[model samples]
Target: MQNSTCHLQPSLATSVALPVIYSLLFPAGSFGNILAAWIFLKQAPTKRTQYIYLGNLVAANLCVCSTMPFLAVYFARGYQWTYVSTECKITNHLGTLNMHVSMYVTIIILCSTAINQYATLKKTSDTQYSQAINENFYRCVLKKFRQPKFAKQLSTIIWLTVLCITVIAIIYNAKEEIEKDSKCYSIGAEANETTAGIAAFVGTACFFLSFTTVLLSYYCLTKHLSKIQKTTCIGEKHLIYSTVKRNILVIQMILTVCFLPYHIFRPIFYVLLTDRYCLRLNYLVEIKNFLTCLAAAKSSLDPIIILMLDKTFKKSLYGLFTKSTPENHQCKADIFTEETSKM
Candidate 1:
C-alpha cells in the first residue's frame, strides 16, 4: 500500500466546483479560528478551569484551519502531489496533529460545559464560571489536598500542554513511511490498520460521551429556564441568560448535525466498498475528501454564529471593526453585551 500509485481524473464540473469551494472555505475557516482564539483570549474567564478548555478548543480549531491552504491546493490540483516528500510528511503530520488535539479538546469542553450549565441551573444569578470555580476548588482540596499546579494559570497551562502534545504527535507520525509518488500524503500505514482503528474507536467513544453530556446538560438547562421564564418576570438577567443558553444550544445542534453524517456513514462505507475497489475507489475517495473539507467548515461557521448570535462576541467584533472616537466609544456601547462569551 505504501508504494502503490493511481491516477485521478475527476469530472470537469467537479474539478471546477471543488476548487471554488475549497478557496472560499479555506479563508473562512482560518479567519473564524483566529476570531475564536481572540474571543477566548480577550474575554478570558476569571474563575473556572473550563475557560482553559475553551481556549484549547479555539487553539485546536486554529491548528485545524492552518491545514486549509495545503489541502485546498492539493484538492485544487485534482489531488496531485507537487510538494517534496518532507513537505508531504509535514502536511500529513499537521493534519493528524490538529485532528487529535481537536477531538480531545472537544471532549474536555463538553464535560466542562456540562458542569458549567448544571451550575447555572443551581444558581440562577451567580454565573457559570463562578460555580465551576467553586466546585473545582473544593474538589481539588478534597482530592490532591493542595491546589493543582495549573489552577491559577489553567488556561495558559492547557494551551501549552496542547502545543506540546500536538508537536510530539506530529513528529512521531511524520517519521512513518512516506510514499514519494503521492502528491497529497498522510501519515500511518494500512498495515497498522488495527492501531489506527483502535485510536479512532477511542476517539469516537470520547466524542459520543461528550456529545451526550452536552445534550443532556442543555436539555436540563432549557427545561429549567422555561419554568423560570414562565414564573418570573423577564428582567435583565433573564434576557442575558436566555440568550447565552440559546446560543450555546444552537452551536451544539450544529456540531451534532455536521459531525453525524460523516461519523455514521464513513466507516460502514469504507468497510463495504474498500475490499472490492481497493484503491480504485475514485468516487469514494473524492466523497471522503469532500466530507473532510465540509467538516472543516465547523471552525469557520462557529465564529460566524458567535458574532451573529452571542451578544458579547458581537460587541467585541464590532469593536474590532469600529474606530474608537471618544464620544462614540463611550456611546453606551450596549449594542449587545461586553465580553467574550464562551460555549
Candidate 2:
C-alpha cells in the first residue's frame, strides 16, 4: 500500500516547515539586498552597466522578500486551508509573479555577465575591446543592451507586463481542483488548459534556453582561460583571468543551487499536478513545494554571494556594521593590499 500510493497527509513541511524557513530567510534577504541597493546606487557613475544589472537584481530579490511574510501566513495556516479566500488568491498571485520575475531576471543578468566575459576574452587587445563596442549595428544593439537606459526601459516593460498578467489572473481565476486543495502554487488540472499550459511551457523553455546559452559561454570562457594560463607573459593581469574564471564558475554554481532543482522538476510536477495523475503521486507536490521555497531562498542568499563576489561592496557593507575609525580604515587598506599582492 505504501509503495503503490504515497501519503497525502499533512506534515511539518507544509504546516510548520515553510513558515519557519521563510522567517529565517526574510531577514537575511532584507539585510543583504538593502546593502546591495545602497552599494549599487552609490556607484552608478563609475560602473553604470554593472549597477544596472545588479541594481535590478537587488530589486528583484526585494520583491520576493516582500511576498514572504504573506506567504508564510498562508503556509502557517496549514490543514486549516480547506477553502481558498480572495486574500489567498491575491497572495498566491503576488508570490508566484514575483518568484518568476526574480528567476527570469536573475537568469538574464547572470548570463549577461558570462556572455560579457566571452566578449572580453574574444578581444585580443584593449584597442580591439574598445573598437568592438560599437563596430556595427548588431554590436550597437549589444552595446545598448549593456547601458543603464536599456535596463531601465526593459525593467519598466517587465513590471508593466506583470501588472497586466496579475490583473488577468485575479479577474479570470477559476476554482480548479488543486486550488480547491489549498495548493495555490502547484500546476495541476490547470495544466490541461491551453493558455496556462502554454505559459508554463514557455517559461520552462526560456529557462532551458538561457541555461544552454550560459553553459556554452562557460565552456568558451574556460577555453579562453586555459589559453591565458598557458602564457606566462600576462603578468599581473593573470589575476583578472583568475577572477573572471572564479566569477563564471560561481555564477554557474549559484544557478545550479538556487534555480536548477525547481526547473528540472517543474515539467514533471506539472503533469503530476493534473487530474489524471491521481492522488498516489501527491507526494511529488510536496517535493515541488520545497523546491519552490529553495528557489525563493535565493534572495536571502544573494547578499552573502554579493559580499563574497564583490570586494568593494563587501568592504562597504562591512563598514556599515563596524566602528568608523581612521586606524581601522588603514588596517583594512593594508589587509586588502596584502591580499591583492598575494593573489
Candidate 3:
C-alpha cells in the first residue's frame, strides 16, 4: 500500500488572509530588524551582558524577517506549490524553522535577562552584587550569567541547540510528498500523523517551561522591587533598579502576546487535524498557519523591546535624528557610562 498525504482543500478566506497578513509582516519585520541591526553594529563593543543577548535576539529576528517574503509569496499563490520541489522544502523549512527558533531563542534570552535583573537588583542597598543574594543559591548561580562572557557562551549554545532540534524536527515530522489524491500544503503528511502528536506534546512542554520561568521571574523581581521602592527615597539607584524591573516586565509582555497563543493551539491543532477530522476541518489548517504568522510577528516587535531595555541604543537613535553637537553627545555618553558603571 502507498502512503496517504494530507489533502485538505485550501479555502478562499485562508488563501486571501495569509498573503495579506504576511505581506504586511514581511516589510515591517524586515525594516524594523534591519534598523535595529544597524544601530547595534554601530555601537562600540561593551562589557554589558544584556547587549550580547539583545544582539543575538536581533539576529534571530532578522532570520525571521528574511524568510517572510518567501512565505508571503507561497501563501499568495494559494498553496499551489508542490511538496516534492526543493523550493517548497526550503521555504517551508526556513519559515517554520525560523519561527520556532526565534520564539525559543527569544524565550531563553528573556528568561536569562529576567534572572540577571533579579540577581542584580536583589542586593541590599550596600551589599556587593552577589553577597546579598548568595543566601539563595540560584541567585548566586546567576553571577556567571550576568557576565558578558557567560552571555556569549549561552547565546551560542541556545542558537546551536535550537537549530539542531528544529532541523531534526522538520526532517522527522514533515514528509512532503504528493500522491494522486494528496494535497501539497496541508497541515502535514497524513501518513506520519503520529509525528504531530509527539511534536505537539514536546512543543507545548517547552512553551510552558518558558512561560513559567518568565512568569516567576517577573513576579519575584516585581515583588522585590516593590519592597525596595517602598523603603528607599527617590534617587538614581531606585531609577536604575526600577528600569531593570520594567524591562523584565517588557520581556514578559512580549512572551505573552507573541508566543503564548501558538503553544496553546498546537495540541488542539494536532489532535483535530487527524484522519478523523482533517478533511472536515480544512479551515483549521489556515487557522494554525495564521497563529504561526502571529508568532513570527515578534520579529517586528523585538526592536521596540530592544529600545526599551537599552538606553545606549535609544540615545544613539535620538542623536541621529536630533543633530546634537559633539561635546553634547560626549557629555551624554559620559553620563551613560557613569550610569552603566553603577549597574
Residues 1-343 of candidate 2 have per-residue lDDT tens digits of 1122222454677768988898888888898788789866653233344455667778878988987887677677533543365655655666555566556766766766665555544443233466666666655654555555776676677667766765765555554433345443333311334545566687778777877877877887778667766764767667666666677788788788877887888787656554444443556756766887988888888888877886666776677688989986776666556433332
lDDT of 1 by residue, 1-343 (tens): 4324444455553456656775787687777768767866765343334345445656656766676665554455524553345555554555534655664555455455445545533454434355464568643332221122343354455557767866765565555554455445221221124445555565566666767767776787788678777887757676657765774586577657766555555565445443444344556555655665666667667567656764545565666777867765554243322332322
The TM-scores of all predictions, comma-separated, are 0.70, 0.79, 0.87
Where does candidate 3 clash, by residue pair? none
- In model 1, the runs with Cα more than 4 Å from the true position are 1-19, 32-56, 76-84, 96-100, 103-118, 125-168, 171-192, 226-237, 323-343
Q: Please give the RMSD to the true structure for each candidate, in Å.
A: 5.7, 5.4, 3.1
Worst 10 residues of 1 by lDDT: 139-148
Candidate 2 TM-score versus the reference: 0.79
Off by over 4 Å in 2: 1-9, 43-47, 82-84, 120-126, 129-146, 174-196, 228-232, 274-278, 322-343
lDDT of each: 0.55, 0.65, 0.70
lDDT of 1 at 60: 59
Encode model 3's per-residue lDDT on 1-343: one tens digit a residue. Answer: 1124335676765667777877788788788788877876775345777667778878888887777776776666526766655666677677655666666676777778777776666543436454556676776676777778988988999889987888787876455344533334655432135655675686678778877887887788777767766887747676777787788788788778877887887777666654455456666667777787888888887777777777778877777688678896687668567655755
Residue 172 in model 2: shift from native, Å? 3.0
Over 4 Å off in model 3, which ranges? Answer: 1-6, 124-136, 169-181, 189-192, 229-235, 322-325
